[model samples]
Target: MGEALRTIAFKVKTASCGGTQCVNSFGDEQLAVDMLANNLLFEALKHSHFCKYACSEEIPELQDMGGP
Candidate 1:
């Protein structure tokens, strides 16, 4: 997706076996990029697509749940 939210910049990134999203807070991009170390990946996970699997910044531990 092309940046639509007035607060955050969303980039759709796909994987070989799943999908993921990279969200950067807009209007306050710099700070948001830095706050990632403190925010929970799952919390940012809402309202987005319910992909077959979700991964944090770099595809941490994940289990396949088949397909939905």
Candidate 2:
């Protein structure tokens, strides 16, 4: 197939270091863990359908669903 797709794997760290006890170096206060999971789930599926490569914390394995 001529279409091209790619996957980006992001490392996620869960810790008590947030807000007053937050230890995140970046100091991001955008999305919460639960919301992040929900959003990631939908985002992953939305992109995975035709992605040549798919990966995420929601998925345990790399998926090849399309032509490179």
Candidate 3:
């Protein structure tokens, strides 16, 4: 998670935060950075092998990650 966040922080510092936009699950305007951060964290947790479920502001529903 730390690594993912760090990567996202670096991206935010080096790139434009408004590169893209879309509507999230909650119908809120989502930016590219927002999606990137969410995907980063989700991948981090999924690969960590301990996260069975996750939820975020961008996706306000619990997601199953095939954990046992």
**Number of the top TM-score candidate:** 3
lDDT of 2 by residue, 1-68 (tens): 11211211231354332534222334434334533553455466555565566554434367564535
Give me the runs in candidate 3 sitting further than 4 Å from their true place: none
Query: Worst 10-residue stretch by lDDT in candidate 1?
Result: 11-20
Give a tens-digit lDDT track for model 3, residues 1-68: 78998999998888786555888777888888888888999999998888899999888899986577
Model 1 lDDT per residue over 1-68, tens place:
12233223332122132322444433322333333332334333432445355544333455343335
TM-score ranking, high to low: 3, 2, 1
Better of 1 and 3 by TM-score: 3
lDDT of 1: 0.35
RMSD of candidate 1 to true structure, Å: 12.7
Off by over 4 Å in 2: 1-13, 17-31, 50-68
**Per-prediction count of colliding residue pairs?**
0, 4, 0
Which of the two, 1 or 2, has more TM-score? Answer: 2
Which is the better candidate, 1 or 3, if ranked by lDDT?
Answer: 3
